[model samples]
Target: MSADNAAVNFSELVNKNKQTLARLKESPRLLLHRRDGEDLVLTTAAKAEQDQTVVSAASRMLSAMARREPGSMELLLDILPEAFPWVRFLPEPDVHAFAVELVDTMRAADSIGNNASVAQMLTAWQHTAEVHSDPVLLAALTQDHGTDYGPVRHP
Candidate 1:
């Protein structure tokens, strides 16, 4: 295939993936939470809004990074304000440790052929959580998302 053809194909793939994501976002299971202590179960409208927010944020972050902008990190951080403040409280090295754990989880999920795309997208979430370690962020991640990284628990 020619280089131009390959580029077109790649763009088509990205668009198709976006459409699929939109459908998934419209599903009933997407969870929505606000910074103002309000949580809403995902209805169709709420899911669409949340989906757009997440997709737009992800796209902007990726574009900023691709442009090698110095402010890319800040832009990425702004999209996830809930977690950014926590990084200050966490020991610096532990941030990367959480990222490693999340990577392993993604690999595991991929090995099982279980929603590999979503699992891969979760790397961004892990990255954000890894950097920020405030009590509120940690608690929200652990309690709400089941991402406990504390002591081991026996079932």
Candidate 2:
């Protein structure tokens, strides 16, 4: 299949998964923390640490919104990329600025619809940036499952 077709198919899948998408229409704070406490515990300690940092950052942003403190918003944006590596993939110049703007918009006292544009953009950016040029395991998994795939790891 052509790259264009593949891109279209991916887009269709994403659209279909809208309901399943967690960050599509909610604040990062609202979407980042899962209700499944056990699932969080199952993640590696390092990953859980990173997740906790992101959660703390989100909570700070939420507090800033509640107090309408511009400085807190600025601080939140400045630390966001460090707290969540995925934010680093956002397009340049606007990445930091847009993060603060998104939180402010999403948490506006009078706002109706959830504003998750930043989260969606961050998710898309991470997805596009992290995808390997050659996903060896994915290619192998597509073949017959019983086929000898050799050792799972290389020294």
Candidate 3:
């Protein structure tokens, strides 16, 4: 199914399963219950730790990108193929150039009161282009799953 239709169907399902959804929304880390009525909090701790790790990794990646570190482009390229499968066929130097251009654009955009990250800015730009230029958008207001082909990973 198209993403937009899937989203509508998913929203309908969520509305139908409000009770279960409420529990999930209330405590995403609520993973288990003990026999003595006490709830295990380890899961919550683990989740928080994982989140912090991701943030830390992202911070390091962004710093490297900003500094134009030697290995930074390689790291970025590694994730690009997974996120944008077409990048798998692109030459390493080309990918590096593209990443550098993207990061520079993101930095410039952030300086002008638009503080979105590189990924966010790229996605927004592509979305805008798809909306304005893609013939599919004219035929049907379908969702563009540009980033849905693969897993998003820390650079």
Candidate 4:
């Protein structure tokens, strides 16, 4: 993110060995632009560790807040709409469910250092919202197929 010596070509690693390493050391990070596929980041191992530690601590704190104070979850529920516009398609109850599941999953993933689990959870929730967004699908799913004539029981 720093402006000075921020990026360098992948080929520079081999061509300018000494210079690239020096730049890596001086700058906080160096973006290694690649022609074939995804770009790579070059930074000190210490910096990477520090970033992970901070993220894990924040995740734990948020999880604890939701568990100890039920009302704290309302704040995260409110932001879901802004963070992901598609959530508005889902009903209010479903949004609350998503917020609870998200915090729990985030805490577990952080504990294990498994980022993929958190990403997968978000993808699943987004897919659920996508289904709700389709009116025809919702109607088909709710349509009554004549079966038992049981009386409705009130909770």
Candidate 5:
């Protein structure tokens, strides 16, 4: 499900607290935009728990499917692009790899009720897709570099 949120300036929370909260009657979450630091989200406890429950259950189900199906990645390959449009930029094999790792990471993170790593993983993969989408950057990145470079070794 899509996140039901309304974005408002952080000052709104301090100045128009009542009006801001009233917005929550329509949207379950308030994304407070901050100028100085990271933005914060204001959400009801019920919404938070509901989101967690959904994530936890989906992660578990995907994990079980992964374990039960040897060709799970192939199955995921069909859906990954729909969920993450940028996955189309990756090679078929790498897309499968990304899907497998993403599902695994989601299962692990949601199992613990902490999604920091899940967010991190998604950002990293999206960046990877971005780089791959740029032919110049992809060629430059895959070019032979110095010894002991990341993902490359001196033969």
Candidate 6:
């Protein structure tokens, strides 16, 4: 196939994936996870306005993550791992360590703010997490529509 055709296919794939994720985005179950050894509890049904706020914040964090923008690390922390309950089955130590390292790397990248480096870091993160994570869980995390899943930077 020509390069142009490949690009079109890639774009179509991205759109299809986004649409699939959008369909999966609604009514995500909230799973509790301990933060600092204490359970961080949140419920989407608390109030309509609150739910909207949560969704908006999550969307912004994801955009930042995708763009590799500055301050993305802090935004990432705002999202708890429990937010993506699907990963609950994975060993906490592995996920927690990965989250911590991700935050650290994002923080370090902020000092220099190199888009290429940030992109590389995000890719490495995805690969590392995929290696340690269950295939089904990883797919849900990457391909599903949920705040807990972070951003799907795949094409």
User: What is the number of backbone collisions in each predicted candidate, taken in the order shown?
Assistant: 4, 0, 0, 0, 0, 0
Candidate 6 residue runs with Cα over 4 Å from true position:
1-78, 82-90, 133-155
Candidate 4 global lDDT:
0.86
lDDT of each: 0.48, 0.49, 0.54, 0.86, 0.87, 0.49
Off by over 4 Å in 5: 1-4, 146-155
Q: Which residue window of length 10 is worst by lDDT in model 6?
A: 1-10
lDDT per residue, candidate 6, 1-155, as tens digits?
Answer: 22221111223334675543343234342223333464332223544456556645544455458458556545554464545443344465655555565455555554454335556855675565555567776666568464586678979
Kindly list the per-residue Cα lDDT of model 3 for residues 69-115, writing each as its tens digit: 77766787677767665554444565676666666665565445343
lDDT of 1: 0.48
**Per-residue lDDT for 1-155 in model 5, tens only?**
24767999999999999999999899988899999999999999999999899889998988888778778757777788898999989887778778778888998898789989988989998999999999999999999876764575669
- Top candidate on TM-score is 5
**Stretch of 10 with least lDDT, candidate 1:** 1-10
Which segments of model 4 are wrong by more than 4 Å? 1-5, 127-155
lDDT of 4 at 85: 93
TM-score of 1: 0.25
lDDT of 4 by residue, 1-155 (tens): 65764798999987997889898677878899999989888888998899889989888987988887767888788888998898999899999998888888989899789778888989998988888999998888878877877998999
Name the Cα RMSD for model 6.
20.0
State the lDDT at 74 in candidate 6.
51
Clashing pairs in 2: none
lDDT of 4 at 15: 96
Highest lDDT scorer: 5
